[model samples]
Target chain A: MARYGLRTVALVYLLFLLVLPVGLICWTTFQDGIAPVIESLTTPSALHAFKVTAQVAVLTVIANTVFGVGTAVLLVRHEFRGRRVLNMLVDLPLAVSPVVVGLALVLVYGRFAPFGGWLADLGIDVIFSLPGMVLATIFVCLPLVVRAVTPVLEEIGIEQEQAAWTLGSKPWQTFRRVTLPAIRWALAYGMVLTLARALGEYGAVAVVSGRIKDQTQTLTLFVEERFQNFDQQAAYAAAFAMAVIAVLTLLTITLLRPREDER
Target chain B: MATLYLSLIVLIPLAAVVLRSMEDGLSGFWAQVTTPEASSALKLTVVASLLVALINLVMGTLIAWVLVRDDFPGKRIVEMLIDLPFALPTIVAGLVLLALYGPSSPLGVDLAYARSGVVVALLFVTLPFVVRTVQPVLLELDKEVEEAAASLGAGRATIFRRVILPSLLPAMLSGTALAFARSISEFGSTVLISGNIPFQTQVAAVSIFGQIESDNMTGAAAVSTVLLVVALVMLVALDLLQRWGSRRG
Candidate 1:
């Protein structure tokens, strides 16, 4: 009886909290048929929003992957002063609000600010531009890869790379052959997380991107704009698309979990 | 190299916000931060986040305990579903809640466009934090202690409260703190569902967005400074709690 009660509470909690909301989105999105959904997604602005999100997400993933791996390797491999502070610095994004992140960018890069004034004189724009959107996305998603890869790097240890070096392998060869394979899954997981986060980023991008429709708007901004404009069907359609991407990422994480555990 | 990247990417922007907030000196900063609108928004954010964290603590710990200790069907699916929030975009999660509980919907609990809506949106976004944090700790707990307690004539409730709860408290506290921080800064979902009504459903993050939208740069920075300070404090506390938990374990 007690076991049944416990299971029931868990199931009901998930049902109300997770299942119903997602199921409602799926239902509303498809209620009017596939053609309208497709049409909503294919509109030029919608297409452009998706394109912006994709571009930002791809760039973010690439940059974070490099930086995340580098930082993780440094944190795990080297003994340095202020290592603890450096470690906490990596978690700043996770701790700070995304809106604050966007605001911080504007403070430093808006036209009246020091950097912003200098850049304005040079005919360059950061805030309310694609670059600003990219920067915010990168800031918000920065911790994903570092947090993901650091543990794997720590677990894999330096022994294998040392062995490779002793066997006359070049540094690059040692890294590629010994280090890369071990952390590959973690890196992939991090990238997927970064992609999802970047794609769905709303607060920071909303603040920085200026929500200029086809110009700076990403898919999430598009959803917000569409919903606010009373375009319920179109809004839900864009939302469903993002939700599908989110689910796909979840599936990938699930599939990768066992492999991660085994290592 | 890492230090430079951290500075450029993380530290410099944070420093810029602090510097900008203090650019007007302490009095000006206080006036901007303590305006009726700003204070109300901050209060709503803190209160809603506390409520959300409290609920998550109880429910998340329950779910984590069940998943760790019980044998159930579709357990893997349930486990996967728990992380749906982390995977789902905040905007999508908000839209989902709005779709189900918005004013026009039939389920009709008056959550949408109200303060409660903010709590619900926050709950969705932060649902997984506590569970994820607590699950591993629960799994790592030595069941033999509980078994030993049972054999020593302690009842199930007594054993849980005495043997298990003490160790689990730190994890729960840290998880709740993380949830609180996440909720306070939560924007995507709350913006849609909270209706953004000032002094009502408006949260600090949403209010910051509004301030920025109106080009109130200083005002936005001031409010953000408040949030940043609170978030930093919570993060430090969470870090310490986790360390304490691990050390004890």
Candidate 2:
């Protein structure tokens, strides 16, 4: 009896909170059949939003993947002063509010700020541009790949790499041939998570992107712009598309997560 | 090279926020934080986050317990669904919740633009923290202790309270702290649902966004500093809790 009650409560909470609401959005999007959904997503503005989102997510993922792998290896393989501080700093982005993240970036990189002024003098715009948006996305998604890869790095240890070194493998060769294969699944997992976060980023990008339609507006910003403009169908359709991406990403992560215990 | 990247991306930008907050001195920062709108938003955010944290402490643990201990059909799917909130865009999360609970009549329950709406949005986004944190701990928990306690004639409740609860407490607390920190800083999920009505449904993040929009960088930086401090405190607490859990285990 107790077991049944607990199960029911858990299931009901999730059903109300997670399942029903998501299901309703999909239903709302397609209630008028599929043509409108397609047309809404195919609009020139929507297409532009897609392009910007792709560009930002790709850049963010590439930057973070390189940074994440390097940082994770650094954290696990080496001992240096303030290593703990570095570890904590990696997590600082996770704790920060996205708006705060944008504000922080703007404080240093906005036109009026000292550094930003210098850059602006150089004819380079940071805030309200692609570079600013990418920075914001990278700041927010910084920890995903690192957090995902660190444990696997720790678990694998240095013996394998040392073996390769003794076998006369160069540093880069050992890393490429020996370490890469071992951490590939974890790397893939982290990249997938980073991709998902980059795709869904809203608040920080909103602050930095200036939300210029057909210019800086990503899909998330597009959704908000359309929704507030009372273009509910277009908003819902775009939202539906993002929802699909998120679900697909979740599916990928679910499949990609290495089953260490069974192994 | 990594140090340079870290400084440029994370450290320096955050330092600028703290530095900006104090541009008018400590007194000025304090006054900005204590202003009517700013204070109210902070209060609402803290109070609501506390409530959400407490609720997650219970329901999250319960869900973890059910997932680990109970057998049910569609369990794999439920496991996958636990991550939906994490995966879903916060704006999309708000839209979905608004669809079911907004000014619509599918269920005839509208929470739009209300404080409860804010809590619900927070709950949606923070649902995974406790469950994910506790699930692994619960899986690794030794059933032998529970079985021994039961064999010694202790009731199920007593065994759980004495044996299992002690083990799960550290994880549960850390998860709750994470959820609370997240709730306080959450912006996108609450933006659409809460309607941004000051001293009513507006949260701290939204208030900061408003201040930024009005070019009140000082005020925005002030509130953001407070939130950043809270997040830092939570991270430290989480770090200590992990150490303590490991030690005890």
Candidate 3:
């Protein structure tokens, strides 16, 4: 009886909160058949929004992968003063609100600020532009890769690399052969998360992008704009597209995740 | 090199927020944060986040217990579904909630554009945090202890309350803290579902966005400073909790 009660509670909570809502979204997207869904998605501006989202996600993934691996390597392989503080700072983005991140970027890059004023004089628009949007995405997604890979790096330890060094392997060769393969899955998992986050980013991107229609609007901001304009179909279609991407990314993470015993 | 990169990317912008907030000195900062708009938004955010975290604590623990202990069909699928919120965009979550329970929906509960709607969206977004946090702890718990308790004739309730509950408490608290932190900072889903009504449904994150949009940079900075401090405190708390959990383990 107790077992049944526990199972029912779990099933009902998930059904109501997770399954039903996502199911409703998928159903609403196709309720009017495929034509409207395609039409809503194929609009020139919608295409542009998707393009912008892709650019941001790709940029975020590259930047995060490089720095994330670098940071994890530094933290696990070496010790330095204030390493603890540095570790905490890596997680600051996760704890900080996305909107606060956007505001911080604006404070640093908006025209009225000192650095922003200097850049504005050179005709470089950071805020309300692609660079600012990318920066926000980077800030928000920073922790994913580091958090994902750090544990793996710790678990694998430095013995393999040390052995490689003793075998006369150069640092680059040692990293390529010894370190990369071990951390590859974790890194991939991190990048996937970073990609998903960048694609769905709205609050920070919304703040920095200026939502200039085809210029800076991402798929998420596009959904918001369309919904507020009473264009419910277009909004739902765009949202559905994002939802598909999210589901696909989740599937990837699950498949790529190390098995329990493996960990 | 890593430190340099981190300083430029992460530390500088954060410092900029603090420096900007101090541009007007303490008096201005006090005035900005103490305004009715700011105060009400802060209060609402705290209240809603607390409620959401508490609810998730119970529900998430229950889910974690089910996942760890039970062997039902489709268990893997159910487990996968728990992480839907983590991968799904917050704005899409808002739209999902709006579609399912908006004013015109057949469900007949007007959750959209209200405080309750804000809580609902927050509930969805932070759902995975607690479950993910507690699930592992529950999994690692030794069944031998429970079996011993059973052989000694302790009831199921007593064994769980005595043996399992104590071990799970730290994880549950940490997960709740994470949920609260995420809830307080959540803007995307809450922005849409809450209607951004100042002094009513306006959460601090959304209100900060509003302040910035309307060109109140100082006010925005002031409010953000408070949120940043709250986040930092939670971060420290989480770090401590993790250390304690590891020690106990």
> For every model shown, what is its TM-score relative to the native structure?
0.98, 0.99, 0.98
Instruction: List runs of model 2 lying over 4 Å from the truth.
Output: A259-263
User: What is candidate 1's TM-score against the reference?
Assistant: 0.98
Candidate order by lDDT, decreasing, is 2, 3, 1
- Candidate achieving higher lDDT, 1 or 2: 2
- lDDT per residue (tens digit) for residues A1-263 in model 3: 98999899889988877888889889988999999999999999999999999999999999999999999999888989989998999999998888899999998888988989999999999999999999999999999999999999999988989999999999999989999999888988899999999999989998888889989999999999999999999999999999899889989988888552376
State the TM-score of the second chain for every model: 0.97, 0.99, 0.97
Candidate 2 lDDT over A64-144, as tens digits, reads 999999999999999999999999999989999999999999999999999999999999999999999999999999999
Model 3 chain A: lowest-lDDT 10 consecutive positions: A254-263
- CA RMSD of each candidate after superposition: 1.2, 0.9, 1.2
By DockQ: ranked, best first: 2, 3, 1
Best by DockQ: 2
> Tens digit of lDDT per residue, candidate 2, span B1-249?
788998998889999999999999999999999999999999999999999999999999999999999988999999999999999999999999999989983999999999999999999999999999999999999999899999999998899899999999999999999999999999999999999999899999999999999999999999999999999999999999999899978
lDDT of 1 by residue, A78-116 (tens): 999999988887898998999999999888888888888
Worst 10 residues of 2 chain A by lDDT: A254-263
Question: What lDDT tens digits, residue by residue, belong to model 1 across residues B31-68?
Answer: 99999999999998889999999999999999998899
Query: What stretches of model 1 exceed 4 Å from their correct place?
Result: none
| Poorest 10 consecutive residues by lDDT, candidate 2 chain B | B96-105
Model 1 score (lDDT): 0.89
The CAPRI class of candidate 1 is high
- Poorest stretch of ten by lDDT in candidate 1 chain A: A254-263
